[model samples]
Target: MTVALVTGATQGLGLALVEGLAQRLDPTDTVYLTGRDMNRVMTAVESMPGGGAEVRGELLDVADHQAAQRLAQQIRERHGGIDIVFGNAVMRVGPDDDPRVIADQYTEVNNFGTTRLLRAFAPLLRDNGRLLVVASSLGTLHHLAPVLHDRFTTPSSLDEIDEQIARWRDELKDRRTGAWPAFVNIPSKIGQVAAVRVLAAERREDDLHRGILIASVCPGMINTPTSALWWNVSTAPTPAQAAVALLDLALDPVKPEHHGELVRFGEVVPFS
Candidate 1:
């Protein structure tokens, strides 16, 4: 059976992804809907159209190392391996949030949280499995300083990417030479996209040849609660619309040109 996992799926695009996957995947396939809160996960599962027979809520807090590892172990022991992994969990640091707290939370959840999922579940991904991390267009490489962009796009390894995140966070917290609090999400998202690119490149010879596809995806300016809270409302697509694009990436046959690329609006975009 095709076993899929979607993290931070209690609401917004993540929740919509669960429904979309259920509708498209084989009837017997299982979709693991996960969130940091069990109450929300259970409520989401209960509200699905089929009462979620094909979906099960799994609690996961991407920033919690032990929680992530435990979930990975549980999935490995229960299902043998994972076929599709959607790293959808994220933390939004707005302009009003404290700079120190913003640096701490955004880096921990958006940057490290995504890496945690990839590192832990990557091993459990069966041949032909797909890994997609949710990124934002604002986080594109061009949005970063040249040096930072270069570091992200051409990282030698995942460790290098992590180091870059650490350095960026340090700068963010620095008064003399630091980033603005409003732009906290950009670095974290950039780090995520870069890490995915590095991983896709690193695993290409062995994993890609064996049918594994790893890449980062941008869902566009989705009209969710998170968006409304942070930015001016616009004619952005609903969470369901964004989910359609993400589910397509998750289930469609992988194209060589799409591997290691940032997929935005359902097309492969230049990483830089």
Candidate 2:
């Protein structure tokens, strides 16, 4: 039986992802939808249409490392391994938000959270499995200053990524924002993509032998509570529409060229 998991699946793009998976996966396939709130998670699962994949709501806070580990272990015990994982949990902060809060929230929920999920579930991916981290077009290399490109594109180790985040935090403390991207989300998403690249590199042998694909995806602009926090979404695609591309990426067979790259609509986006 196919087993899949979507983080932050209670609402918006995440919720849409679970719904899409439900519609597409077979009845015997199982999909775990996770959120920080158990009530909301169950509610979302109950709201899904019947006669699709077996949907289960799970209480998961991607920012909580132990919580992620426990859930991964539970899934491993029950299902042997997961076939798909969509890293959809994220935090969005704007200029009006406190810099201190922004630094902490964005790093904890967006950047490191992606790292936590990868660490927790990556090894449990079955052969020919797929893992897609839902990043954004805003994470493009052009969004960052030239000097920072090499650091993100070179695929640093997870510990090195942590150090880079620490360095960013220090820069924020010193009020040296000029060296970083204008918005914290850019660097945060970049870190997510970088982490994916690192995992892909670390698992090169697995990619060749097992046909596993791990990459970050940009879902494009969508009308979601998260995007509404930043810009006008009146004309943006609905969450369901955006979820189409993401689900396509997650369900498609491994494409050797696309592994480790940041992709949108089946195309590789330049990292630098």
Candidate 3:
């Protein structure tokens, strides 16, 4: 039986994917639908239709490296190996108005926390297992160039972004100026690209054990709680819609051929 583990599954895209996966997973497969909220996550799981895959809600804060590691061990103990893992939790780190603090917070979770998830569970991902990083079109730099130069920078490594953060902290002694925290938030394109690049780089070898496929997906500007403000102003896809795209990668029969590709909707969107 193939089991699945998803972090940040309480609501928005996470919950949407869990709901979709619940319907898609076989009856024997187990799924760890997780998020930071215990009650809310449990409620979302129970409320969703067809808990066929041993649906269970786990209160997980992936930002906590120890907790993420422990969770992986628990999954390993319970299922022996995982068939699929969606490392998809991300957040802006601090108060939006305060860019310096905001940059710090975004860098911590969106970048470091994501790596933590991969580090904890990469070993247990079964051979031929697929790993999907729910990245953002916002993270697609080349697409948002020329017009978005003022708002977004070219893609770079999380380490690069972190270095900038460190520099911003030193330069901006005053948190009131605002852009200090914002500068550390790596452009969305960088976040999406870096996730796949880092994942593949970390696990390039070991093809013999089982072919693990990693892809950075730009799910487009989906209408989630975080992007609700864009609801009326911009055309946004639903989480359910985005879930469909993600499911394609998660359940693909041929992974190695598609690994490390940046995909959007149903197409293989190219990137640096």
Candidate 4:
């Protein structure tokens, strides 16, 4: 029986991803959807169409390290290991938001949250499993200043990424943020992609030999409440439409070349 998990799946693209997975996975397969609140998680699961895969809900605040670790252990014990994981939780900061607050929320939820998920769940990926992180095209290294590229791309450990995020947060708090991109999401997304790259490289041999694939993906611009918070979504694809590409990457045959890369519409996007 295939077991899959999607974090922050109460609504928007995450909800769409869960729905798509339910429809595609076999009836015996299980899909777990998570959100910060139990009510919202259960509500989302109840609202999904029935007679697909078995859909369940759980409370998961991706920013909580211990929470992620506990859930990972629970899944490992209950199902032996998971077949797929979609790291869909993220925080988006608006232009009007305070820089200091953005620094904290974005780094905690978007950057370090990704790290926590990777730490907790990556090791439990069964053979032929897949782990796909929801990043964005804006996450490209080119979006960051030239001086920061090497630091992001060549991180020796996940802790290095965490340290870099902490340094950026400190700079924002100290009002010494000249080196960072004007928008906090840029660096936040870059950090997420960087974490995925670091993990993929660190596990390259094992992943290849075991037929596992890990990747970061950009779903392109999508019309969702979160996008409405920051951009014009009138012309953007709907969440269900954007989900097609993400679900494709999650369910399609594992591609070794796509491992450790940022993908969009099934194509590898240059990190630089």
Q: Highest TM-score: which candidate?
A: 4
Q: TM-score per candidate, in order? A: 0.93, 0.95, 0.80, 0.97
On a 0 to 1 TM-score scale, where does candidate 1 land against the true structure?
0.93
Q: What lDDT does each candidate get?
A: 0.82, 0.86, 0.67, 0.89
Q: Clash pairs of candidate 4?
A: none
- Across residues 218-259, which tens digit of lDDT does each residue of candidate 3 receive? 777776555653345156778788788788778866445456
Give me candidate 3's TM-score against the actual structure: 0.80
229-267: candidate 4 lDDT, tens digit per residue: 888999999999999988988888888899999999999
Residue 12 error for model 3, in Å?
1.2
RMSD of each: 1.9, 1.5, 4.5, 1.1
Tell me the RMSD of model 1 versus the true structure: 1.9
Candidate 1 wrongly placed segments (more than 4 Å): 51-53, 176-182
Q: Which pairs of residues collide in candidate 3?
A: 93-105, 93-106, 99-181, 99-182, 100-181, 103-181, 127-210, 139-188, 139-189, 140-189
lDDT of 2 by residue, 1-272 (tens): 99999998989988999999989999999999999999999899989987779999999998886888999999999999999999999876655788765677668888788888999988999998998999977777788889888767654687777677777876876787766866777777888888888888999776758888888999889986667878899899999998998888888777898898899999999777
Q: Choose the strongest candidate by lDDT.
A: 4
**Residue 257 in model 2: shift from native, Å?**
0.9
lDDT of 1 at 110: 87
